[model samples]
Target: MHRHKILVVDDEHLIRWSLEQNLKKQGYDVLVCGSGEDALRLVQDEAPDLILLDIQLPGMNGIDVLERVRDVDAEIIVIMVTALGVLETAVRAMRLGAYDYINKPFNLDELAIVIKKALESHDLKREVDQLRSTQPKKFSIDSIVCASDSLSRVLDMVRKIAGSDAGTVLIQGESGTGKELIAKAIHYESARCDRPFVAINCAAVPETLLESELMGHEKGAFTDARTQKKGLFEIADGGTVFLDEIGDMPLSIQAKLLRVLEDRVFRRVGGTRDISVDVRIVSATNKDLLAAIDEKSFRGDLYYRLQVIPLLLPPLRERRDDILPLAKQFIADFNREFGKSVHEISARAEMRLLNYDWPGNVRELRNVVERAIILESDEVLQLEHLPREMLSVAGTSPASQGLNLVLPADGIDIEDVERELIQQALDATHGNQSQAARKLNLGVDAFRYRMKKFKLL
Candidate 1:
């Protein structure tokens, strides 16, 4: 938002000199040019926030410069400077998007006022643009970061699904497994990238209003229907409409939805006309739609129609190889967000991250990293930064959590169970003793003694 550099363009030496001195006094980085050609070059090089342009210049007058400046960057604030009695030319300058104009009688106070207001307005605009630019990085198949083969296969499926003209897509996953992110990746990777991508959660809306929400209503359809409206399908025509939590959509709406899917046309809530749309319906649900169908809550016909291209997102715990990589990616994001220099994850913290079964999936991991980055002020992320719940769960066995075991009529040896567990850990880690010890939550010496006792060396 800080208005840094400015370029002053005029044919007169005194006009340029006076304006340069004034702007410099105001703590602005000032660049001055007398001719239109030099002014253009300075604009291209300096990329100034504001330009003080005179209407009469050597080659290609101020209006010409203003027009070309717009071509290069339309956001630059321009204020025209003209001689007295040139109202017609000044009017022409305004038409070319000049912010304001100052006449011959150099009123420093008035010029200062114009520049201050213009830059303030421009600063507001730039701040809004900056906010829009920093929104969550758009999801595309190429932008997804992962290190696990399980997820790699899922992403590979997504890549093929996106390239094809598969109109109906059903993303199935556990809650917080980023079903919507996968849906966006498919839409953005496809030819519909330039069109709108709208989303609505079927569970969040009431069953009474869900139909009206998805398939607009004509006026007088209901008491609240004050006017005709365009539904998500119509609004997202030639694009995509992401129906999150489609399993919760009521059966009545499901019947209507099946018609839309089959025929590519739908009737408004109270209208007879069939409004046709060409939107890709991307639905996602964490629930077992097949089970819902068995329960008769979800329509089987709709389920089959919707699952034309079924995409399954693997849970985060199943993709443990990606844990550390995703954690680091979140760390980098939070470092920029919180202005911290946290770069390393302590060994113990890494072990904790790799051990926990994140029922909440990637969303939980992102939140944990964000919390750690906000609270940890050091260069490394450590165990102390973790939530209390995570601390209690890390490296803890199920038996330690009060899980009871029933012994058979003939009791078995506990040492044999321990030995078998140790062997499995070693095999899982491919004989890396240190990692095997970590997996068993034992010290290297303790594991070595067990190895010697069991003759596992």
Candidate 2:
């Protein structure tokens, strides 16, 4: 839980103070200096994890300082702080080994996001460097565990696609099928892992701002356009831009996105200059784009363009062979996370997990295992540890155990039910906390926390 120390190098005292306060508020240790010379001394003295150096510094310009910093310790991450229309300097700073550059007068929220991403990238880089001689890749087809032939075939396709330089890939699947996971596997397994891998959910943003989000906008493009901003496409140049839920992208923006796919260039909103990018577009969606085209909501040409290499992730129900394996893997993961000793699923629990339809797929399965691990203390996971819904959906229950807890059709808060269960266990055990905890198969600390939460102690 070491707090990341951020060094703020800005000639303007207000900017330095503002950055320091904001960074400190975000739980980051902050160091501030006005000159690049002083910044270098701080690098040697404080050994800040990251440096936000202003391009317009008073002396020993930010570019020079960045070069010297990299030369001294390439491990230290440096993000350039630029002003409006200083594209050339930012690009130069990038070439000189700056991790990223943020514009002045930036939104604190966006700046926080940038800093977080830079640090994450720095950590990944260090990990990769350390494991270069041993680990082949952090992301690979083998990372996904599945024995189902259906998934195996899909992975075979992914293997071929990852090695190829195909630009536009369309991934279609049902909800909870891990579309973004597939996207990342493609990106990190390819040559673009070192560069930025930016993703934006097309359905998450409003139609009014999707254009600016993709292509960026000039400082005064619109009423709220306070400064020039880089979009996902620009940021992901020479890397990958994952457009999640691309079927939800509006028609107007769809045409522009198609143009970028076709020509590899685009202009900023309200700007005449063409900004070229060499990013691979990997888009995914749960919607049927062809049907959207039939309804005239989506562009037919764009649909064809996006599906240059089509990938379909089959639903969990369809891949029944993968269900048990995936559940066991999730069980192992939750065991480590929850500090539980649960090692194996009971025969009845396995049957229930395999028989019940996973409407939420892998995500739902993970949640189910997490909840079970939280409530289970035994080395073996039993049927009663699962949610009651599983029995309801599977049309059976472990009746021999002689436990009766029926949830109403209208449903009740799970927390309320948990409190009632804890109280009942305590009552049955004559208020002996250890016996009550043992009766519920819950860890002593977990059982006590619930007791406190329900005001039972």
Could you tell me every candidate's TM-score relative to the true structure? Answer: 0.72, 0.59
Q: Kindly give the stretch of ten consecutive residues in candidate 1 with the minimal lDDT sum.
A: 401-410
Off by over 4 Å in 1: 9-13, 24-27, 33-46, 53-137, 223-227, 393-457
State the C-alpha lDDT per candidate.
Answer: 0.85, 0.84
Worst 10 residues of 2 by lDDT: 393-402
lDDT of 2 by residue, 132-215 (tens): 633335456677878889899988888888898889899999998878888988988888777888999999999999999999
